[model samples]
Target: MSALPASRDDASPLSARAGLRVALPIVVLIAAIVAWDLVVRLNQIPPYVLPGPLLVASTLIQDWPVLFGSLLTTLWTTLEGFVAAAVGGIALALLFNQSRLLEYSLFPYAVVLQVTPVIAIAPLLLIYLPQETAVIVCAWIVAFFPVLSNTTLGLNSVDRNLTGLFRLYGASRWQTLLRLKLPAALPYILGGLRIAGGLSLIGAVVAEIAAGSAGAGSGLAYRIAESGYRLNIPRMFAALLLLSTAGIVIYLLLALLSHLLLRRWHESALGKDN
Candidate 1:
């Protein structure tokens, strides 16, 4: 038999193509920012209504301490909530995967929790718990469902052939889960993580908006509200820009982590041939 040619996985053409793909978005972002700055400058818009990028940048530079402190608080809260959600969601997903009866009984409750509005629940949580705890709980509620749903799907998606192989090997349930199902589910869990990362930040901000900030625990959302009330438009825009940047950073970080983890073996982590 004749041998076929090798596949081009690491050639210059492939690397250059990937570089171009990455460069395209960055170029678009720079163009958009430039266009936005030009439009604001040409229109001579009032800072109170629509601050130019320069004004927002100046405000951010001037209020670095206050804004950075608030950003840290928000980031901390989101990280706490997201971590808790990731752990709890995976645990619950495993439990649900163990039995169809349990899944039927518990899955609806999870859906109900997910459907309940965080804004509506935040007030009640605040009344019942400490402010920080309330905020964390609210954030967890908002972020948990995606992880739960995605992880559950991953766990259940094991191939029947694999399941039979594990059974033939006399694998215990736990052994099968640890060695087979969990590995298979990693991409799905990471997918949920990417989504939950953004949701966690949003949840923290929304809870802060609904419940208001307590001393020593205020976040960027509180700063935004404070700026709006005081008519500090430039400062508000600065806070908003920080929040947007943080969200984007969180998403990109999770995506990169997912790609790194999957790149060794997963098809989804690799590019397709044209």
Candidate 2:
């Protein structure tokens, strides 16, 4: 009877946990927005300098059509950049894992590239490539490093004992890697991807900002730049809000994906056991 009740208690849904998880952030956000509104009103801050929360919200609604289109454009660019980074990073990490010489020869260049700012490179990319191509490349540059480094770390962190056990059982290299190492690395890889998702959006925004100044862009960042030039402060705020929301959505989606894929076995994903 005690066991039954204990099991029943454990079996209770995680919905309560989930609700608390969501509600706390919503509450804090509401409080922050309210405070922001008060500050603007109390200080008599000019809209051109900093629009209040209500004005920003109103602008978002009023300017949704143009803002929405720009939002889609930016999102598409981010998705493309993210896909490219994921593929290139994972594939290169695999190659580096397989060969020490290759790793030594190429890894420093990767670090150097990462350290170099994408904004500095954007103008040159625009000159050499088309505007759209330059923007996508900028997005890829900033998003690539975290995935590459994380995946490489994961690939190298496999248990030595399990490796030796596999060798003792006469498993082939590929078999050992596929069966044991990759499984262990899945968590790290997913974590890298989550970081990459937000980074890809940031890259897209920065590149778009550079492109917007050059006068050939249509993304949300471009809209912001255009708005600034026109003194359309409300529209600028609306576009900025959309960009921020898109970034949050990207992070949440990646986090949800990581959780779904890891929940059954990984420690990070497993809630209090039911």
44-94 per-residue lDDT for model 2 (tens digits): 999998899889889999888889999999999999999999988888888
Q: What is the Å distance of residue 222 in model 1 from its true position?
A: 0.6
Instruction: Give a tens-digit lDDT track for model 1, residues 1-274.
Output: 0232344776556566667789989999899889889988899878899888888999999999999999999999999999989998998899889888989999999999999888888888888988899889988999989999999999989999999999999999989999999999999999999999999999999888876545345699999988888899999999999999999999999999999999998888986861
The clash number for model 1 is 0
Clashes of 2: 0
Q: Which ranges in model 1 have alpha carbons more than 4 Å from their true place?
A: 1-16, 213-217
Q: Which portions of model 2 show Cα errors greater than 4 Å? A: 1-21, 272-274
| TM-score (C-alpha, index-matched) for candidate 1 | 0.90
- Against the true structure, candidate 2 has what lDDT? 0.88
